[model samples]
Target: MPLPLHLLAVAVFAMGTSEFMLAGLLPDIASDLGVTVGTASSLTSAFAIGMIVGAPLAAALSRHWPRRSSLFGCVVTFAAAHVVGACTTSFPVLFAARVVAALANAGFLAVALTVAATLVAPDKKGRALAVLLAGTTLATVAGVPGGSLLGTLLSWRATFWAVAALCLPAALGILRGIPSGRTEEQAAGGPALRTELAQLARPGLLHVMLLGTLVNAATFAGFTFLAPVVTDVAGLSDTWIPVCLVLFGAGAFAGVTVAGRLADRHPGRVLAVGGPAALVGWCALAALAHEPVALLTLVCVQGALSFALGGTLITRVLYEASAAPVMAGSYATAALNTGAATGPLLAAATLTTGAGKLGPLWTSGALLAIALLVSLAAVRGRARRRQPLPPSEVGTPGAR
Candidate 1:
């Protein structure tokens, strides 16, 4: 791996930490800010909404900027946002800070993925992409857990300060590692964004997006309420809650590691397999929440299988886009944010109807099934068309 990839991974770790630290700090924030817990919870939702709006907007705006500069700017913006969030005692002020942090997170992720693609050979892109994306899993495992602990002991404000501190080092690392920004070289008969958009016009892309949306919605809905589900529904001991989260995060980390390698061989097959496995995992979780062993097993599997498709799917989008790596990165990030926002809202409605945790699982699984169908169809369509999506350009004349 190149030095730049390692630096990007570190940067991603800081971004992921900042993005998710709020989940663990909500209670602390609510109490300190003199707001209801529900109100504080809105902070997380607001960030997701910010990501949905920010990803594409950032990409469009930075279309001509040097990629490293774009990424560095985002990191600085995120660090500043965290400082503001920590200092603000006012609810509105903190909320505004969250939006800023979210925009930075969204923009950084989009640009980072585009940078990853440019840093490696075409055949190794999947693994390269995975290295940076892995920071997300690390955040879930290490950052979120540590933040939760810190919020409980010190102050929620202290947690944000810690996040800001971590980011400074990450930004410094990027400065030391990655080269000045560059772009992919064009292939003969290279396709333009319009051509890529036409490919997206196919039912396959629509289905893939739908599936991504469903996967997120179900996961978030159920995940948001996981603590209650474990205690209320499954009757598990509160002491064991961390065990489940650890298991889930471990699964996610392992999934990313494996998916990175597998994507090079069969992006479509990985999605097809992983989606159904996640659907089954969710079903098992709902059916056997009372069975500690079964629940833990399923949660781990759910995390592992569901996320296994992530790198592969992103690579697929970029490949299909015919070297529009930035566009693919932005749009995929947007889709992910859309799902992140939608899943919880939709799940809330389902749970409000007196439907148990299982309701979200059903919805999620159905959506995954749909996504799987779409993936399969896309693969079949590509096979039928006989010409695989064109190879991306190495350094398109004006890509940088």
Candidate 2:
């Protein structure tokens, strides 16, 4: 990856740690705030909700700002939110901080995607995005677990403070690495804001975005409950949760690396294989939830399958939304975050119904099944659109 892309990835790493680290900290948060763990989980929902609402709004609001300034401002806000989170005693304040941090994260991602594409050759945009997203994978492997350890060794507030501190250098990296001007996407964004908004509503782009959303929903539905599932269903020790997380993260890193290499050239091939495989992986997860050996293995397998499929679908979003490059990142961010919000909330509801850990696994499998069907439909639609008409139908009135 280029230095600029690497810097953006580093910034993403800083941001993603806060996003994923909450899963590990939820128990401590519940303990500290005198709330049930279930209630504390709302913090996870709050952040996703922020990203859901923020992606498009931030993209539109910052559309006219210099790319570097927009990115720098977002990171700075993200840092400030963490500072507030660390200092707050009230659950409501902490919850509000999660939303603020997520808004910043969403804005940075929205701008980062456009900037990343501009930093690389047109043909390499997929890889560029993969590299940027790889930051999240790295965060999963390192930062998430690192935060968990920090929360364990010191305090949950320590995790917040650490994330706040990390953002300082990340803000500087944005100012140093990202170019200071109207980006290429901004230049292509016609004077009318409606032009960019129209892309979100475009059926083809929406289809791809929907596919991305479903895959992510399936992935997160299982992931959000990992700590509990490892301990309760698999009968593993709390110490095992971080190890499981590392395995899943390792798998995610590998999945995204392969997607970066193949998605641009073989998007259909990847969709054909990845969708069904991800669905099957979820099925295995549900079936093996009680078997520690099998459950742990499935975690890694599902992670790889989910991210590979999800990453490709997102790459398709960029391809489909190419006409509105400035808004493409917003579309992707909104898609992923929508799933992030929906999946865990649904899983949490299932848990409240006394479905046990199997509920989340089933929830994940069901979402993946829907994703598979959507993927198949999308691939078929793309194929039909690309297929040539017969000679007799060529230039015919009916064909037209």
Candidate 3:
């Protein structure tokens, strides 16, 4: 028996809400904790660091555990950490809780992706992943904004409690829904840890991971500073920022849906189209930041392109790393998180150089252009090897 895909989506929703909601509540949290906003912002960095460190650790430690049990433990720990965060008044204690939650988040996401791939037919892997990631997309659209509103209406603590409460249904669903067995490959005595590591070290797989990292870095470079872009550059009032965010989220949701349908049939084509679209979108955003209509349109297009590229990248990685999908999934997660952490730093540095509000847009456009070139090189390299790619990887439907 297989677990219901919706259950996994629900679990991802809870985890993603916790991961992203902090951005919306930073000011409220800072005021309540008597810390400066800059200091409070470190909490987000801490969560990203925890994810980078935790994904590999979880993959290593839980490789031999039953998949369902491992997922259950992570969800419970994540919920408990949120409870602690909600109750804590001290900044350090809340930060610690954030780190713990992020560790659990990393573990759960890695396992969930592996399980999703296993549950579906090879041809459906891209669609399965798209459904799973839609949860995160919803988190950005609904959870983050709702959490922000909850904090505004009550207190930031209430928002934490609300997130913790969300975990209960997700945990119960996992416990009851996931079938009792090792994952598909693991049940057949999957490759040893050393073997998986060696597979992960392949040059082709490394190129794919690098592409994933670069795509995320480009997306986040502009996204991290979107509020400032909206107000300072687009000349929009602060009140319109949330509306802009919702628009971005809507575009992401739509992009993921379309990518899910097309990726299995055209993985390479998806990347080829999305990478250039994102580059154009970012450059347009840089030049037209002061034009409210153009700025809004570019923002939505940039959001769509980012997720479209991401979906294709994940499908490609899974195809290339078929021998040890679980561990490979963790590597992908860690790489993306590393890029997420790096992007904000890059944007901040650009701003410091007096590049003005357009700094992040131009910076992200440059990164996307480089990523596009790398992607093109990777496609050509894979073609030159003449190795038989999976049907999905070859960008043909039913090639197998």
Candidate 4:
């Protein structure tokens, strides 16, 4: 029986909301906990660190378990962590809960990707991944805003309670929809741990992982400071910032939708196009910081291209690490989280150095340009290594 991919997407939505809602709740949390804003912000850092460390650790620990069982356990743990966070009044306890929740989130996502891949045909793996990731896109579009609204209307702790409640339904869906037995690929057995680690060390695989990190870092460098950019540089009032965020989220949803249709057929081409598009968008944003309309347009484009590039990059990693998809997925998760952590620091440093509000945009553009060059080199390398295509693939654009 095929697993219900939508259920996995729902589970991802639950996790994404928990991961992102923290940003909106930080100030309130600090006020309630009687801590400095800086200390409250460390909760976000703790969650990122947990994700970075948990991916490989979870993969290794759950390597022998059935995918369905692993996912169920992770999701349940995630829900429990959120409950602890919601109920706790102590800052340290809530912070610890966030870390535990993040660990469970990483574990669930890694296993979910593996299970999604197994459910689909080999040629449609990219589409499956895109579908699974759409949950995160939807979270940005709907869940984050909803959580923010909930926090604003009630207390931040109430928002945590809401997210924890949502996780129960997601867990039930996973239990009902996922198969009880191991996937065929798992049953057939994959490469040994030694072989999987060796594959991770390959130059091509390493380059793809590096590209993933750079792509995410570039996106976040500017996005993490969007509130200030909109207010100070673009000359928009605070009221319009939420509108801009919605636009960015909409673009991200569109990007993932397009990627779902095209990625399996033209993964390389998608990367080629998306990488340069993001670079151009970031450059335009830096130069047009004073133009409100231009800033809004460029932000939307940047969001779309960044997410489109991300989907294709994941597909590339899966292809390159075909023998160990689960481990490769874990590595990709860790790399992206690494970028997520690094981007904000870089953006903050630029601000402290007295670079104007446009510093983050320019910084993002520079990083994106380098990632684009690496992607182009990778494409050329792949082409050089290929033999003449069969009659079937000769006419296919993706074959190139």
Candidate 5:
């Protein structure tokens, strides 16, 4: 909606690209750095670990700092890390760079969500978050695929160079686009850091975030291993991998778009419908893996439902923490990264069983079921809170 929001999305696009761009470049990175593919894949894990750590830590540390400065500095650090990765031949150096880059990515996202939320009106908070998060889903459609193509045409190192260079314009835009003044959250004269952190520990906020985490875990569990499902179970060619990716990404784009429209007004109804629909999608995904047409169709549906649910959950976290906005985005970021890191690990475990290529989909179903239970509990909790006190309890000062 606002120019500054678009500018933030521009930066998010670059950051999101770098965050997952390596999925396609891992082999090349391994070959160039003289390591096994397994070893090179650790870069992804390293980045996830860094993000899990950086989100809350960076947000808390920089809670008092200027938003523009935090945003700009994080972007610069991220770009610099990519430069190091592009130039370095040593595996350890590249690994370290990945971690640093993730730290920057996490910090930038945490603050950016807060800044985006603050910039818009209360009613449009969901729309604002969706606009920003669209960059990420768009990255799946364009940035990751583009990076892979760049690596194929040139070198994997060249792709890193491209990612690094992409941030330059974004950094400059952030410098000029975002304001340097105190936001409403800051102007509230928030409590001390210790108190702010304690506020985040409130059960309502934590319940919302936990729901977000479980939903994300389910989403990632299916997604991380989707390529194998396409090739092995769906009986598709390697050429079809990117095509399926495009379809899924397109669905994700559509999902967030729809989510942005209705999330604020109907979060419960949306989640109630979408959550079960997603569970069904996961079940069908596993059962239909052998049927390519069915499999591919489900892929698109899953993407849309997954991201729609995700966007809503993130917005709910913001709503839950509205009274104590400090570090709210950080907690959301932590939940996000926690899900990102754990989903694959859990799915991998399922894969090792007799389930074979369909394991991840099953894992997704199980995780979604858990998330839905949490959602149901949260709904009940809110209903309980909203109920008027009994007449006797209200009348007596210390009713038994």
Candidate 6:
């Protein structure tokens, strides 16, 4: 709705395209680098690891910096990493590049959440965040597919080069368009990192983190092995891989849009509905892997349910924390990264144990069940806290 929002959107679009392209281009990259596909896949893993380690580290390190400047710094770092990745011939060098880019991407996203939240009214926070998040969704629906096609037609390295080029204009747009508002100045001193840590000591917040962990694990369980499942297990062709991913993306886009709107209206209901749907989808995905049409149908359902919960859950965590918005954003993102890292590792372990296509889906279903329980617990905990409050006070709310 605002110019700053558009700037943030553009930045997110470019960054998301850069990050997801690696997955689509993994085959080309691995072949070129003379490495195994699993080895090449580690670049994605490394990036997530970096984000888990980077969110708080960047937030703490840049405690006093202006939010706009911090965003700028992140883009600069991202651009540099992309440049390295594009030019480097060695797999190790490219892996390092991805790690650097991931750290910067996490920092930028953390700051952007705070910045976007400040730009809109309290009532519009979920919608505003939805707009910001749309960039990433669109990348999945559009950018990743395009980059993959380009990589298939040309070179994987070219995709990285294109992303690097995008960052230059994105940085310039941030400098010229996005307002360096005064909120950053006021927000700088709200709470020390230690105070934020103490607040996370609250059981509610801790459970939220655990919920994030489980939900993400559930997502990765099916997703990490999606390519192989669709190809080898389902007997689909490799040429159709992007098509399947785009189908998932279409589902993700719809899910995110619905979640954002519903969160703006009734986040609690969305949360309530999400878990059961996700659990069902996970089970369905596992069961339908051998049936081509059923597999695609189930994959779309699973993708929609899994990602739709993202905004709702993140917004819930931010509101519950209510300590420091920026800090909360950082912490929430870290929790997400933690789950991301865990999910793939768990899936890998299952695959190693001869579970094949079924392992990830079963593991994900279990994790979703766990997340569902935690979410119900959170709802119950909130209800218990609100029991003593006045009706007028109890109905009021905030979105991170």
- The positional error of residue 8 in candidate 2, measured at the CA in angstroms, is 0.4
**lDDT for position 287 in model 5:** 97
Q: Which of the predicted structures, 3 or 5, would earn the higher TM-score when compared with the native?
A: 5
Between candidates 3 and 4, the one scoring higher on lDDT is 3
TM-score of each: 0.84, 0.93, 0.88, 0.87, 0.89, 0.89
lDDT of each: 0.72, 0.85, 0.80, 0.79, 0.83, 0.78
lDDT of 6 by residue, 1-400 (tens): 7888878888998887875666567667888999966567677677778887888788767766777789898999999898899899999999898889999998998788777877888777778878887887777778777777778778888888888888888899889877665465355566777877677788867876778777866775566567777777889877666777777777877887888788767986876888898898888878878888988888778768877787777776677666766577777778877777777677766766676757878889988898887777777877886667666676678411
- How many angstroms is residue 387 displaced in model 5 relative to the true structure, after the best TM-score fit? 8.1
Residue 133 deviation, candidate 6, in Å?
Answer: 0.8
List model 5 lDDT by residue over 1-400, tens digit each.
8989989998988987887676566656777888864466567667877888998889888878889999999999999999999998899999899999999999998899888988888889999999998888888788867876778678888889988998999999999999987676677767667776776668878887888888888887787677678778988875566666666778888999999888999987778889999999999999998999998899899989998998898898888877656677887888877887777678767766899878989999999999988878878888988888898688787653
Worst 10 residues of 2 by lDDT: 184-193
Report the candidate with higher lDDT, 1 versus 3: 3
Tens digits of per-residue lDDT for model 1, 292-392: 78887887787677667665666666665544555667767777667777765665456555656556555566656666676667678778778543447
Off by over 4 Å in 5: 23-42, 88-92, 152-155, 380-400
lDDT of 6 at 79: 90
| Regions of candidate 3 where Cα sits further than 4 Å from its true position | 1-3, 30-40, 235-238, 379-400
Can you rank all candidates by lDDT, best first?
2, 5, 3, 4, 6, 1
TM-score of 4: 0.87
Model 4: pairs clashing at backbone N, Cα or C within 3 Å? none
Model 3 Cα displacement at 356 (Å)?
Answer: 3.7
Summing lDDT over every window of 10 consecutive residues in candidate 3, give the lowest-scoring window: 238-247
Name the candidate that leads on lDDT.
Answer: 2
Candidate 3 lDDT tens digits, 1-400: 2446779998988887777676567667888999965567667767777888888789878887888898899999999999999999999999999889989989988888888888888899889989998887787678866776687678889889988899899989988988868876777778888888888778878888888888887877777667677777878875566566666767777888889888888987888778888898999899998999988888778778888888778777778788876687788788777777676567656775677767878889988988988877877876777877765667676654
Off by more than 4 A, model 1: 27-40, 184-204, 234-241, 356-363, 373-400
Model 2 alpha-carbon drift over 4 Å, by segment: 185-191, 379-400
- All-Cα superposition RMSD per candidate: 7.6, 2.6, 6.3, 6.0, 3.1, 5.6
Q: State the lDDT of candidate 4 residue by residue for 92-201, as single tens digits.
A: 99989989998998898778877788788889888898889888878767776677667767888888988888889898998899888876656767667787778887
Off by over 4 Å in 6: 184-188, 377-400
Global lDDT of model 5: 0.83
